[model samples]
Target chain A: MFNYIIVGSGFAGSVIAERIANVLNKKVLVIEKRSHIGGNCYDYRNKDGIIIHKYGPHLFHTNYKEVFDYLSNFTDWRIYYHKVLAFIDGKKVPIPFNFNSMDILFPEILSKKLQEKLLKKYPYGAKVPILKLKKENDKDLKFLADFVYEKIFKNYTIKQWGKRPEEIDSEVTARVPVCIGRDDRYFDDKYQALPEEGYTKIFERMLSHPNIKLMLNTDFKEIMKVDLKGKKIYFLGQEFKGKVIFTGMIDELFAYKFGMLPYRSLDLHLEVIEKEYFQEVAVVNYPNDYDFTRITEFKHIHPIKTNRTVILKEYPKDYDPERDIPYYPFFDKAAREVYAKYQELAERFDHLILVGRLAEYRYYDMDDVIKRSLEVFEERIR
Target chain B: MFNYIIVGSGFAGSVIAERIANVLNKKVLVIEKRSHIGGNCYDYRNKDGIIIHKYGPHLFHTNYKEVFDYLSNFTDWRIYYHKVLAFIDGKKVPIPFNFNSMDILFPEILSKKLQEKLLKKYPYGAKVPILKLKKENDKDLKFLADFVYEKIFKNYTIKQWGKRPEEIDSEVTARVPVCIGRDDRYFDDKYQALPEEGYTKIFERMLSHPNIKLMLNTDFKEIMKVDLKGKKIYFLGQEFKGKVIFTGMIDELFAYKFGMLPYRSLDLHLEVIEKEYFQEVAVVNYPNDYDFTRITEFKHIHPIKTNRTVILKEYPKDYDPERDIPYYPFFDKAAREVYAKYQELAERFDHLILVGRLAEYRYYDMDDVIKRSLEVFEERIR
Candidate 1:
């Protein structure tokens, strides 16, 4: 008998499991289909003894102090500020189209003029997305916006989402910004660093509580079949007294009553080389040129001193419900409508608390996932 | 009888083969120990359909028009200007420590001062090596030089050569330079490009001549025991009347009677990822961080539109006489003395012409090797 049964061992479920065991003194069973924990955040020591992320580069960054502080309890910090470069026109330039980038790409006169215009229009440290800048009436500003959109955003968006920049939702394009200042960092977060011992160590510490029972390589569907018994929850062919916390797909939980929700998955190619290091920075974005979105050198992320290095290349793929695990949820009108019906259906069970990126059918950063888990614990579990 | 017995099918042997078959209209036999042609320059489409350099990234760039024009007969050019970035202090700055790199790494005042000093000391397009720059008398220039040497050169040299920076030859450290200008390119050659169809295609076209017979998976040692018989060449239990061009290690040819000349070998790790592209550039160099020297993303070198990408990492290791294929000759005084003895022994046979990087015991760029082959043909073979 468990006090709560949590599906998935990703950040969402693990964070909830930690809180349930520590804060509420409850016995929690976390069911994960994958052999390993941490879901997309799973990292391990390779054969060459380099710590590598099995998935693409998961850069831990957030503006939320609470989320940062909570994670700090689990692992020490490496204080890594992530910076990215995009290969365009046979040159590696600073991404986010900052002032330094403008100087690198454009002519002296044109770059100066654009810089003056940008500084005049926006605050010194402001970050304006290409889509918002594209709506500008000024010709110079429009030109700058269009240049970034075409060179850096368009092809990447098509490859990443299988849709044109215009066809995709504005939020997708809005994530990539054009900075007015000379700060070349990819993210402007108050808390930006990698776990000193790697992300896996953090998850190891968080889920180490005695009350939290982790059952990996076991799917939620296999453990218990949920059914409605006159407005009472019955699971595993019995009246389940424990509360159910489903952190997997909401539509899958309800057996696709509103058809399948769309998602974008990634196929990652990881290689270990006999070299000490590879690449300039942690990640390099190939927006306009290559088929893959970006290449991440793991040594740059963790700075491990080894004779060998590991690198991962990310290829954007269409999620197959039967084959692929859901990664990024596609947020469109059709998806929203399908999710709304699922949300309404989920309301029938008071004991069932649907949460996390997959269950809610929304995209989330590491910090947001942690914050969401904390909020869910406070509102429902407590 | 063959007109020429060319040992090793790399640039050295292949160039001679092409020249002999086409220019002199002579029959030539090329013996390669490796299963494939092109020697170290051999690149092939792997299982994932991405072209990879079996050894490492080979960027073809040369100032000599004759060398470039001669090789141009074999394959079309991709017109690729190679640029490298160094991962130092958590920033992706251009290598060669150019004016732009100074701006990225140092404070505004210090960067401006150093820029002015560099411009004043060197020509607009001049590249001054770190060792040369370290000899500067000016306080500002010395600081700049020391900064680059410590950050970019020292650790990389230590890991690469297995020796301290001071212990390594000055010529070795003299190869990596500091640019006076804002040019972020690794090389400032007049002709800078890749073989449009990959390096293997060039070798394929070069060796496709009817007169050129390629015998792969065959070493010269296995086929023949070389001995001077009254100025007559004998091979494979038969009298061979042909010019023997040896491109393999000269010391190995003598059976290491004077003790084996030292050489460094590379262990390459290759991986095929399910991504379309990886990294912003073809090669990323890690100087201060990792044990491996660099990581090369193949798609950036040859842009083939595919859902997968290939990467190669190079790990430098001490050459084992029995196990490793000698890639780089150690230029230490003791090694040079041993090589001198081998050269003296090689000079005994009038028909035996020692050629290429390994045979000559010197590091030669792609163009230099081709140029040396032409010169050798004119002076000796012709």
Candidate 2:
């Protein structure tokens, strides 16, 4: 009989299992539905002899050194900085907007003037909410905010967030800071890097330990039938005792009592080119006049130079109940209300600790996930 | 005659004009190459009276209080948070990877076991890499990561990045972090909000200062024919005498001396639905098995409480010199080499300040752009 049963093998479940077994020094059983492990941050070689991120381009950037260092133990470290470009008007511009982009897309004079104007407008230590001098009657920097939102963020937001500037939470804008200085790095962090080896290797190392049991191609729902010792946790709704840890969606765990939460789905078109190298950058964003929001060049992320290359065309799609994988959770009032109900139910569990992206319904970086998991162990499990 | 000439009425240009004219009491003339004044961030009412971001949906999200506070002066604030979904194999999963996902896609038992395995192996701070993980590895964390990358990220990355995981830089993976705790809020920040009225209005206010002059449907290339009081700055073969602030691409500024950088472009398929609302979330992503990458419902972004709705289907394409707007910059070694040459030439301009997304050749968020521009002003212009 196992002392603990955890659901899913992604960061959430993996973290929980490792912590519990290590702290309690008890027998732990981890079951995975897929043939392999790692929920979404998995990487492996394909038939085409290309090492690809199986789900999507999973970039591991974090500000927390501990999380960074922790994951480093699993995989080798690579000094990679995430660079993105936006394909607009037949020109390649850096993603998030930057210098060096001006002359490529715009005529010289126009580019120069625009730069000067931007510099003058955004002085150092400017305060939020950006207040435009002209629209005095307007509050909350609506006028100037709208202007930036339109050009810098709007269409892309519509494509990525599936909403307009007005519909999104104000916090969304807060996440993407407007820079007064000219440094074009995707993330603003002192410590940013990627695993030299694939993220899969890191996960493999994290999971490869003794005093643990792993079953692949096995479903937790089926395992629920047998009586198990200890507490049972239903991640995907399989009954298991022995301190069950659920990492799936909270609403799904409760069977969508508050109506299905809105979620945006995606469709990706992947192709390989015979050229030794493809695009100049790793990721290219489509902000205007594009069916796809972005294109990713695998070579940009992985560091292996080869004669052949692979790429993925990212297309946004509507969440379909019948035929799609839900990637993003819609935290609209309706969804939130539904989630709230599930949260109540989840809180009722005594031994079960609901954690991870799925359990919490929040988007987190890899480091954040580790930090959060560790926090849970420190506060509850331990 | 205008005392100061400002090109491009986008946020970058408008903000500068407004600040200099309003605060510094300087006369400014604004010129826009596009027919409209707001540049790429233009939004207006269509025939249906439904507000549509002309360029695209721009969701304003930032972390800097100053940037947000500055925009507050121009317009009112709106409170909205966006959600995204992924459509794969006929399933809708929350984006950024969340809990409610496994139930609809994987079988109940399998999903539960997968969760268990993840927890068992990971076991909170295993301090071991998944790669080094042994068969007794309870979490199979690495395997799960591989599974996610394969099922979702792999194909999508190939379509988005144009390179395989092995070939790309590790930095890409680091940028996308996995979540350990479930919170499904795509971004975790203190402040999240948007512009109340829209983005275009903000531009109008920012550029409406008395010291600023406005010109639309005019290109700086045409204006270069007239003389300005400044040193002669040569871009490729063209010469300019005014203090030039470039916001275009670095390669084009140098006339693609090292050869034009490769960038991916997009083709958008738009549809105007006559319904008040459509879909559950705002954005949806398609990882693989689709010609297009994703679909976006405009109402999710705008939420105008209208009977009319708009949506866009995104498709990725090879950037053609003649068609499509280049959105992302390709940072291949060749392009970088060419950019290096351009950089050398750019240094000759004592009065010129290269700014915006293109001039820098680096990926920048809106905050980054604003911050960068401000830095240039403080260090160089001031």
DockQ of each: 0.01, 0.01
- To one decimal, what is the Cα RMSD in angstroms of model 2 from the true structure? 37.1
Q: What local lDDT does model 1 show for residue B83? A: 80
lDDT of each: 0.82, 0.63
Tens digit of per-residue lDDT, candidate 2, span A1-382: 4577776788877777776766677656666655456887877653233567766788777778877776665667777778777676677766455445555656787657655655666674332232232233443234434544555467877887777766876555555444444455676666777776677666666655554555443445544432223323443233445577767666655556556767777887888888978888788887776777888888788656456788988788778867776677667666667777777766676676788876777766667778998888788777
lDDT of 1 by residue, B73-160 (tens): 9888878888888887888788878989989999999899888888888899798888888898999989988888888898788778
Report lDDT (Cα) of residue B201, candidate 1.
78
Candidate 1 lDDT over A1-382, as tens digits, reads 4688888878999899999999999877677776557888998655333568887788999999999999999988988899898887877788877999988999999999999999899999899988889999999999998999899988899999988777787667779899999999988888999888788878878777767766544566654776634545554456667888888999888878679999998988888787777778888889988789988897888765557778889899999987786778998889999999989888888788888889888888889999999999999899
Once fitted onto the true fold, the runs of candidate 1 whose alpha carbons sit more than 4 angstroms away are A228-234, B1-382
Residue A4, candidate 1: Cα error in Å is 0.9
Point out where model 2 deviates above 4 Å: A47-49, A102-110, A120-148, A173-177, A225-241, B1-382
iRMSD value for model 2: 31.8
